[model samples]
Target: MKKTILVTGASSGIGRATAKLFQSKGWNVIATMRTPEKETEFTELANVLVTKLDVLDLDTIDSALAQGIDKFGKIDVVLNNAGYGLMGTFESAKRESIIRQFGVNVQGLFDVTQKTLPHFRQNKEGMFINISSVGGRMTFPLMPLYHSTKWAVEGFSESLRWEMAQIGVKVKVIEPGGVATDFGGRSLDLQHNQEFAEYNEFVNAFMKAMAQSMNPETMTKPEQIAEVIFEAATDNSDKLRYRAGADCEQLLGARDKMSDEEFFAMQKQILGL
Candidate 1:
């Protein structure tokens, strides 16, 4: 029987690319997003179900899972790709943005995993592929909130692997570095307060450095990351982490080779601090 994969945040970017890639590979895809009605791309695709699933909304999570299982009979894999970055200084961040960043990136992921565990447990086998970032393992200036949540995801996924393994459920994390996605555009929430003008110069320098480093021409493509996800899904290995980009490999490799102080110094030098 053909396997089924459910992907959250399927309206765009990595989520959309992964959903389409799986579908093209003959897997049934439950492509979920907050507003399914506005999605026009996956409507006509065979074995692809575009449905509503807001990670923060438990009702939607349950409904989407039910809808997928009802149609495809079983869901063999779930890609938790619904998250965004909260950029800017933490001091300038509103309480709402802080809460929301954790809500969607960390709590929402927990909710989805908790809800899906039963199904996977019952099946005696399943896989969960979470979309983290190079930010998860390292950090840069002005994105503490985004980095914190991703770090949480990394720790959670790593720890969950042991427990999930007992139930025959596999847990994997994909750490992509600067993918060419709207993550820096529509998917990013910039927090700034006029009162915190002292941070203005620092933020400006950081942004300029980021712009140079995150050139679209150099960044990994979402489709490329999707291929990595697919490999993790089908590789049938006990590997817990898959680095998806050359940048990821380089940055994470450097991180592994350096001490904490060295890494911090390198990051500071990169931002011209």
Candidate 2:
């Protein structure tokens, strides 16, 4: 039987890239997004099933899972790639924005994972390839909220991996650093306020440094991430964590080697604070 994969937030970037790559590899692709109608490219493909799946909406989440199974008969892996980064200063962020950050990044991811549990439990064999960030293992200025969500994902997926071992289900996390995706552009939510002009110098410096991190020469590509996701999906190894690109390994290496105070001091020095 051919393997099948379900990908959320497949409109563009890592999700879109993964769907295309998996389809090329002959895996059935469930390319889901918030607006299925807006997707014009994937519909023409024979094996691609473009559907609506907003993470915040439980109805759509369950419906998409059912729809994928109805078409493919079985789902081997679920790529929970439907999240955006909530960037900028947390202090200046509106309460609503802060809540929505957790809403999409943390709560939405949790909801999707929970919804997939029943189907995975029934199948007796399945995998959840969650897309986390290297930020989960480290920190960055002006991205406290974003880092918090990723840290939550890292913890959640790690614990889930342990618990799922009892069953046949497998959980793996992909930690990518500064991938050159729309994640740094349209998908990023920034907080700003004229009322808090004092932090502008630090904020601007941080944004500049963050932008440099996403330069094509320094960052990982979405297609490269697709390869890691594929390996996590098919490698069948019991390994629970996979680092994508050299930047992820290096930065996370620093975090792993440094003490708490040392890491903070190193980060402050790098940011020129």
Candidate 3:
């Protein structure tokens, strides 16, 4: 009678860590990724069900959920951890990048949650953990679209929580500051805008500074997020959000404690922008 959890983007980093941690805790884990075969880490784990799932693909998402339900009888939690980051100035950002960002970050998460609602309603119990970011609360230069999506998740998850309250379904959002993950590495979409070559040097320096500033240790570990997620899923509390990193704590604190001008000025000073 172990509680079952389905985690998307389970091939690497946060998603991978969350899935593994849940498995270690004896929860039945349906760990899914764009291509599960490409990831050998979860393939051999005990109590982990590796499946292929690309959040952008509707058919694949549905198939994975159906298969998970068949195997586990019920899904106690759904973790929407599948997403990537797009970095560039607003003027330099491409339409396609914006679409892709919203597609996976917002649309994909929405689709997955919608797909699982019937099951949760039927069972009268389930938790949906949506992965947002500290950027949602505070934004930096050249990350407009990325910030927009996470901000959307913040609003969306909160609204969904109220809507689901009567049915015993919980929607929780985890806002982590940059963690030690490839999300800011290989997953970062760093396209140059020759059209804005005027700002090329400035933009390049900014991007490099970002990579340098995001020291993993200064941020949170993926396990920190996993631990927080575990609490959200099992604690049965009324809390609707959890901030999972030191950077998040600082940023949220600043948001609460500082004026708009003070906050923006402090951020610019820290980022050297």
**Which candidate number has the best lDDT?**
1
lDDT of each: 0.94, 0.89, 0.88
Tens-digit lDDT track of model 2 for 1-273: 998999999999899999999999999999999999999999999788999999989999999999999999999899998888887777788888889889888898899889988888888889999888898888788788989999999999988887798779999999998888887678998877757899888888878876665687657889999999999998979898899988889888988898999989988887667
In the predicted model 2, the residue pairs found to clash are none
Task: Quote the positional error of residue 184 for candidate 2 in Å.
Answer: 2.1
Q: Per-residue CA lDDT of candidate 1, range 46-148, in tens?
A: 9999999999899999999999999999999999999999998888898988999999999999999999999999999999999999999999888899999
Candidate 1 has an lDDT of 0.94
Error of 1 at 34 (Å): 0.7
Which pairs clash inside model 3? none
Clashes of 3: 0
Off by over 4 Å in 2: none
Ranking under lDDT, best-scoring first? Answer: 1, 2, 3
Candidate 2, residue 111: how far the Cα is off, in Å: 1.4
Encode model 3's per-residue lDDT on 1-273: one tens digit a residue. Answer: 999999999988889889999999999999998877787877787777889888899998899999889988889999999998888777877788889989999999999999999999999889999999888888888788888999999999989988798888999889888789898777788666767778888887787788788887776889988999998888879898898888789889989999999998997788777
